[model samples]
Target chain A: MGTVAIYSLFIINKSGGLIYYKDYGSAGRMDTNDSLRLASLWHSMHAISQQLSPTTGCTGIDLLQAHNFDLHCFQSLTGTKFFVVCETGAQNMEILLKTIYELYTEFVLKNPFYEMEMPIRCELFDLNLAQVIQKDRVALLGR
Target chain B: MIGVGKAKQYANVLDKPLGRGRQEVSLSAFAFLFSEVVQYNQTQVDNIAELERRLEDAGYAVGARVLELLCHREKGNRRETRLLGILSFIHSTVWKVLFGKVADSLEKGTEHEDEYMISEKELLVNRFISVPKDMGAFNCGAFVAGIVRGVLDNAGFPAVVTAHFVPIEGQQRPRTTILIKFAEEVIHREARLG
Candidate 1:
């Protein structure tokens, strides 16, 4: 079995604030400010795309492809957005995002100290995220 | 009480560096837990108000905990300073975290300056519940109200939160509204501060 090359992850709040961000594989280092700007820009683009949809309630962009990587976005009902950057053909991106969101709900939201619409720095969330990513990697490697 | 060894292990878990997330609870498990809570309160209470109060008391603890956790998550340990800020936090953040969606709407009481209401078309907790007619004006939403009250009281807002069932035309599910009435001191303080 081949490996799943997951590149990075970003979480944006409703008002287009970058709440959480992480890089898994080296997708090249982006400056913090640049990454934040990218998140907000993507958020606006998502809204614009939704507006362009003929349906009244259009779910925004779910997938975007580039030359080398693919971006998969999962938007929660409350408008919190999760974007995962993966290798061009990474499978089960939706499943991965769902698990990530679940981890987020359990650890970050449940933590008594986490503030809303802010950068997620919860220890438990980070640990579980790593575990999930590693587990997926191992599964992909057929170990 | 837990044994010393077990307590120590728990402490160790807490001491571990951040980002180690806890396991997620299934909705069915939560539903079962909530049902048991209601059943337990039903057996213990003589009146609907008493039952609701017990449920509210149970939810109060959850609310208090959620309030602290959500505050930490959103503001990086800083809490909401104003009444409107905290209300919006509860209306948007708390509802979203708890129900996987934000409440339908938030409205101020036209008759009362110190009152506000957060309304949900269908409350997650009440989804599977069918209130018996004999229960007489009882709503399971009291648990949520208790939670809201717990959050506000802990945040130094000191408000009375109550849950009411408002039936909307052509809707099968009765809408749940959590009404908040701020304490006199809170309003006075907010006025002076603002």
Candidate 2:
């Protein structure tokens, strides 16, 4: 998928629960159980990485590079994590994740019916996420 | 600017100047915060009326603080004593500082002596929300209505404030009208002052 780069996006809440997951036409899509397990695994790995650091104030893993793809992780102040798996050495992943965080805050957190620290069900959030990821991440910065 | 690349210290938070009673918040940021306010209130109530009342109560807190803040900073410590004077203050000064623009229209009711209306084409809080078909006759503007009520009550002009959607024939989105019906004492005092 040359035109569409990102494989999938997963959002983990403060307590390491999978709150949101979206796959943008990946070759192999994981089941919901697999997705939840992946989220919990990432959360623990992030914590363990911080402890493994020699010096103090070490934040968890920011990027994990595999032969096939790259995984980028962004942690908010409140411990919520947003990770995007994309094509190898994908550009502007940081910017993309940050914008997604903003979208999460606006559409999901702001929605009156939405329960906090739960699975995201807002239509606006889904629509906005699709638009941002499908297009070039750099282009969305003007907003 | 004095201490670059250093943490600034304050003796007391209250000792700082009020800073011209104007602040800027990005529209997106404001929308998110407003949504949180709505959502928090939603979890606490069951019925629509209760939800609206809770939202209004939240707005009232904001309005009361805003009145106190503006009265000190903008009006040189002189609070508005007249009904028209206070309405103008809210319509212009308070609206400008909080919402970045004045309300669209402020008019006295045609039939009622004590009633007044402040209309906004698209209230900032209502911008992103599209009320569901099932949740009929519910408007997020109730929070703003509470704000108006808060301001009026704090100013010693106790009134009943409510928000309604007034449909305009050609417009796609109906306008929000904040209706204020003054207490009997306010009307009597106004007549005495006149």
Candidate 3:
């Protein structure tokens, strides 16, 4: 079987809590606990990178490229983190992350039941996420 | 103020950011959130005044941050010092951004030296709010009143702000009046400046 281009997408709250996780690929799906660990560890590393940077006004790491897969992250001004893991050469992921942030503001933040900084449980958000993921797939297939 | 446009079926919505600027940090979200705040506070308070006060306190924080942002972006960080100047700023500049239109009126109280009124046909916070039987005369505009007070106080023009409902004879809904009564010091300073 061929390899899946995208692995997963994650949404993290400001304080490094893993608020959301979704897996798209059949390859190497992580247990929930492991994904949670990955989010907090990545959060610490992102913060440390800011502290370690010699230049002023560091915004922390945005992309991590491994041998086979790449991770792209976008942090909103309000400090929520949205990241996606994809094949190393994936395109338009930054725009995709921004789209996710936009949907988040509309469906999640606006939802009255959504307590601030809590896990995302809104079905509207999940429905929109699935649509975004499908669009990502269609875009990649035409490439 | 939020324009709910048709959801254009772009081949990929992720292709670009939504048109112009409506997608960026929605203000409509705040409307729903504010309603939730009112509902939550309703369970906690017994009297209408107390409930409105709680909602106002919540709006105070929002107003303080809004002042900081508007001053930085809209006024080039220049703070207003005079009474009428600041009142006009809130009436025109701040009102436009916050509620999508300039306030209906900014008038001096005929009977009072320091009292001023900024009236709106319907405040966004109170537009959809239906006061309960027990919440009679509550005026969710109290949140907006707090917001006005926060902006004036932060701008160094301290004032006592409150919300009132004045029903028009023909209109089904009463108008919202944000009453701004400047403190003695502010009035004195205005007089001295004059």
* Among all candidates shown, the one with the greatest DockQ: 2
Q: Could you give the candidate ranking by lDDT, starting with the highest? A: 2, 1, 3
**Which residue runs of candidate 2 sit more than 4 Å off their true CA positions?**
A44-60, A105-115, A122-131, A134-143, B1-46, B58-90, B104-139, B150-161, B164-194
Residue A117 miss distance in model 1 (angstroms): 48
Please give the DockQ score of every candidate, comma-separated: 0.01, 0.19, 0.05
Instruction: Summarize candidate 1's per-residue lDDT along A1-143 as a digit string, tens digits.
Output: 44657878999999999999898755478889988999999999999999999888789899999998899999998899999988888888899999999887766664433467888876557767889999888877874
> For model 2, what is the alpha-carbon lDDT of residue B30?
79
lDDT of 3 by residue, B1-194 (tens): 23478555458757743332342344576667776887798789887789878978887887787788778767877978888888999999888878888999999999999999999987877644555434467687899999898899899988889999899898666899999999899888989999
Clashes of each: 23, 0, 0
Tell me the docking grade of candidate 2. incorrect
Candidate 2 vs 3: which has more TM-score: 2
Candidate 1 lDDT over residue span B54-141, tens digit each: 9889889989998888877667888998999999999888887788788899999999999999999878777556565566678888
Give the distance in Å from residue B19's predicted Cα in candidate 2 to where it truly belongs.
Answer: 10
What local lDDT does model 3 show for residue A4?
A: 57
Candidate number achieving the greatest lDDT relative to the actual structure = 2
Looking at model 1, give its docking quality level: incorrect
Any residue pairs clashing in model 3, and if so which? Answer: none
Residue A118 error, candidate 2, Å: 1.9
Q: Which 10-residue window in model 3 chain B sums to the lowest lDDT?
A: B16-25
